[model samples]
Target: MVTATALEAELLELAGAVPDPELPVLTLRELGVLRAVHVQGTDTVDVDLTPTYTGCPAIEAMSLDIERVLRSHGMREVTVRTVLAPAWSTDDITPEGRRKLREFGIAPPRVRDGSDPVPLSLGPTRTIATHAAADPDPVHCPHCGSADTELLSRFSSTACKALRRCLACREPFDHFKEL
Candidate 1:
């Protein structure tokens, strides 16, 4: 495995600290977007970032924020590159990020494993344990912690999320869809 120099590490931390434009509650690091930071020369650095998904409009904002941060921290030239290889996954979200998402009234995407059963959300309280790799896990309401929720819309405020209403709490919220 490659190791980062102290300066690179520091720069990485700074770049990762920038907040996501869409989900302001989580940092880029927490969202697992800031991939790496490499110091090219004395005053130049290159940063690799993966968006939450392809064609994410927020990538430009994230890049600007990262560049501004690194430039202010003594780097003369900062290059933020969008990396598509090893596409970003919901599984990349840190545990803390998931917690923050829940706290912010968004249902975090359920973690997935290849061995796990196919999750199919039949309804707010219905489930079908089939062999299909669908989202079978119930999107619990973050406010009331109730599994009784209904999808109001396939897309929420963002394309990456779904709008849901909790039957128990009668509150509407967004669910970060699994990617």
Candidate 2:
């Protein structure tokens, strides 16, 4: 692992502070996409960024934002490289980010053990039950805090989120899907 110099760390923070284009509520750092920043020369720097998923549409905007932020911070040249290896996962999201998402009326992705296989509910939405015993970690409604929620659609406003409806409050919300 490479240790970051004080200057590099400061630049990283500036880059990380850039708000995500798709999710304005969360910064790139909170979203866990801003990987690292390396100073290449006196005024040039290179940054590593990972997308939430492969071919994420917001990547270009994210790169541009990072470059703009760095340039304004006195960086003569800034390059944002998207790295695919060590894929980005929902688990990478920080606790603060999750809380912000929930406060923003979006259900945050649940934490999971990477080694374990995810439990799959294969039955029809209406027939399936969301019992506590059945689903230990049910996607609770961000609005009413109810576990009684059903998936309305696999895709929502963005590819990363899914549309879900809370049976209790009769409200629709987006749930950030576990990557």
Candidate 3:
């Protein structure tokens, strides 16, 4: 007995509850991926979401999660749409999302000065010896809040993150790599 307006509102609320599959701390809205929500009649809800990265494996899981959440609320014929025009960036992450990420044991993306060098390296000579210096800005440890961290692996449980350990806290955490 729900009106179209009420159904749309309910669907949005359910969508808001569905977190990003890869980054559980961020919801689709917080990630700036939930572009549009439309109520196609009474039983159908259309959701527009942009993928964080091209060919991201999490997209499938996220779409499924959205559908599941909507269906639980008695929404039938839920349609999850993917859009990729503008693309996603760390800047798209809201302040609240950043706070959540930090609390969830992942350091938020740090703003970098353009003067840090294009390759973030001196030259080919240094690049051959050490790839470490090539990183423009050092990633801070999420646990200890220290800059003294080392990259353990380029890819974590998810492809979008890198595994790092805090030298001070001796704790391992994920770092959202700069794309």
Assess every candidate by TM-score: 0.88, 0.93, 0.75
Among these predicted structures, which one has the highest TM-score?
2
Query: What does the lDDT read for residue 146 in candidate 3?
Result: 78
Expressed as tens digits, the lDDT of each residue in 1-179 for candidate 2 is 88999999999999989999999999999999999999988899999999999999999999999999999989999989999978888888999999999999999999997646555556553444255566778999999899988888778999999889888898999999988
Each candidate's lDDT (Cα)? 0.88, 0.90, 0.74
**What value of lDDT does candidate 1 attain over all alpha carbons?**
0.88
Higher-TM-score candidate of 2 and 3: 2
What CA RMSD would you report for each candidate? Answer: 4.5, 1.8, 5.6
Candidate 1, residues 64-97, lDDT tens digits: the string is 9999999999999999999998888888899999
lDDT by residue for model 3 over 1-56, one digit each (tens)? 44447667767777877888777778987876776668877677888888878888
Model 1 stretches astray by more than 4 angstroms: 115-136
The number of the candidate with the highest lDDT is: 2
Error of 3 at 150 (Å): 2.3
Deviating ranges (above 4 Å) for candidate 3:
1-10, 112-137
Give the CA lDDT, 0 to 100, for residue 135 in model 3. Answer: 51
